[model samples]
Target: MTEPVPAASAPSGGCPAHADVLPLYGPRFLRNPSELYREMRQEHGPVVPVLLEGDVPAWFVIGYREVHHVLSHPEVFARDCRRWNQWDDIPPDWPLRPFVGYQPSTLFAEGDEHRRRAGAISNGLFAVDQFDLRLRSERIADDLIDAFAGRGEAELMAEYAHPLPLLALAGIFGMPEEETPGLLRDMMTTVNGDEGALDAYQGICATMERLVAHRREQPGPDFVTRMLNDPANLTEEELIADLVLVMTAAQQPMAYWIGNTIRLMLTDDRFSLNLAGGRRSVGHALNEVLWEDTPTQNYLGRWAARPVLLGGQQIDAGDLLVLGLAAANGDPRVRPASDTPALGNQAMMSFSYGEHRCTYPAPELAEVICQAAVEVLLDRLPDLLLAVDPEDLEWSPSVWMRGLVGLPVGFTPV
Candidate 1:
């Protein structure tokens, strides 16, 4: 491991004037974040200042060791957004409100509350039979491919990667087929922070409430029922909040992982040749993408609970910090100088770490779903090829997630 980088000193009374507060949104950063990260690391070390959607100042931890330290010491760094010092200053119409704003779920909880909520989520998800989940995912993949297999060319992001995870999650939650489409639309709208986001969010809440009521009346073998029966005894509001977390987490990251992995397999010549020539498996491709281009590039926002020195930087109480997962994964200290694959290496912080580390079955399920989706598509469309030049591809503008805007491809029509 590389020695952790020391933080630069700030003035006695406030944040250092020289701190580089990079804009996380907008076209420039979205286009080539890796380049910007490289520059930031070289010039500013790991803990750089950054502006969120509303020009909100926060620390962006980019070094692998530094991020690991920050995540490990949750005692000093807290998850509760109520600890944020400038929370009152942020306006209501911030574009990233839906994501960075406060929620009642475990994502924003700490200590005992985190444990309780996380336990409920784990119990709920654990009740899901992995085998059944795989089958469901495979079936969804086949059905989705069938829709575009005849077209000979299609945009995979919207037509396939984007919907498969949502459909699978709906199945796991036992949502009715009639209601799944509307639910997905509402969730998407909320995530994009577009027009009617508030209305769409309300729609989601209403739909979830209906689902909970129906499950209570007619219990079934599903995630909601499992949570309802868990010893955690989550309140009705807590149940709804946790369910929303699970659905959002499952859908967005899985979609991005599938899309990013597929993009790598289709565009990177070495990856494509290795997989085709039997030197690499879909798992290898997936792992490489996780390391180099993780779907959730930034996450795990923490507020400094009290005055502390982290990686030599002085952080006052209520200071906000976000882990740069993608940047940390590529941190030179932990990664090799060469581009060779590090087989069996699972040290990446994409899923994060410490007390809030993502419980198993969720991450495993995502991997299985993504791998299954890719295999089914490749098997069905053997000659799948990028419809546009790789350079022309674009990524969505997001501070927390990194995903392609679209993935257009051409293949032989079946």
Candidate 2:
């Protein structure tokens, strides 16, 4: 836990514009957000007024119950980004625009429209053969391990953790083998919300457009084709845009899930005992990462559909509320002690909650991908150990993601 810093003055129960809000970005937050969440919860209740990049004001929902409340009551805290009242101040090139900027995607849709797209997506994903997915994931993992098994050392993040999910996803989409690497690059760039994010997002959309067009002409036993044939009858525009949303939702988080689980197994003594051949330990490590170090930490989030009092603060219509998933998982009212491993508990809010949560079989599919990636690597390199000190393994700097920058490790040569 990090040392406590002085909290910003509490919200005046009025417009957040005048409040002395906490800035959500910066090195401190990227380095240790749980400690900051703890301090914020102590000072202000669960809902704290916070400033995003460019001093944009929003509410950060940190309490377990409070986050559950916000997610459950979509009528009050809605998904539509257009309801935001700060658009007047936002520029087209804002770094965070990709998050709040409305597209025709299912991510920001609400009510019946959301169900249509979500239902189609769920059905499409449900159609995926879990056994086939596992087989493909194992093959991909084996291929990735082969490249580094001889060297006796590797940086797992770039070489293994990141690529495995994308590679598997590409196969599911029936994307050409040569096109996947570029797709992977653009997807990473887009999600990081950095300098080239907008361009990369456009590139992703263009690629999706071409894929949809090709599938329309020549349907196959792939996810895109399944969605195209769904009963929802999504328009070409909706299919293209929502395909981007699907990729965005699946790839990055799955990568971090694999990476964080491996990190836990390597660093924690409990997991080390079973590192060589314990599926049970691997399962525990994966679950524990979801509770303690969820990949999607904070989501760009619900807008207040109308003025309402919540957590002792009066939220005005059009106010934005960021869901604090990691913080909620650590809430003292519900979570176990910091030192205790959350082994069997699957109730963590890591995959948000409510209708907007990761839909049905999608989470199941992600688990198949992630579990296969970890199990295969362990089977191949049972003696894997961190090359650098545990403290030296730095995390990615993005406030939205919780993943290592790189995970360098070494093992005996095969």
Each model's lDDT = 0.80, 0.89
Per-residue lDDT of candidate 1, residues 169-247 (tens digit): 8888888788888888887777766778777877888888989998999999998989899999999999998888788
Model 1 global lDDT (CA atoms, 0 to 1): 0.80
Candidate No. with top TM-score: 2
Q: Model 2 — TM-score against the truth? A: 0.97
Put down candidate 2 lDDT per residue, 21-135, tens digits, no spaces.
7878888766788888888888888998888877778899898999999999998999999999888877788888887899998898899999999999998888899999999
Clashes of each: 0, 0
lDDT of 2: 0.89
Error of 2 at 229 (Å): 1.0
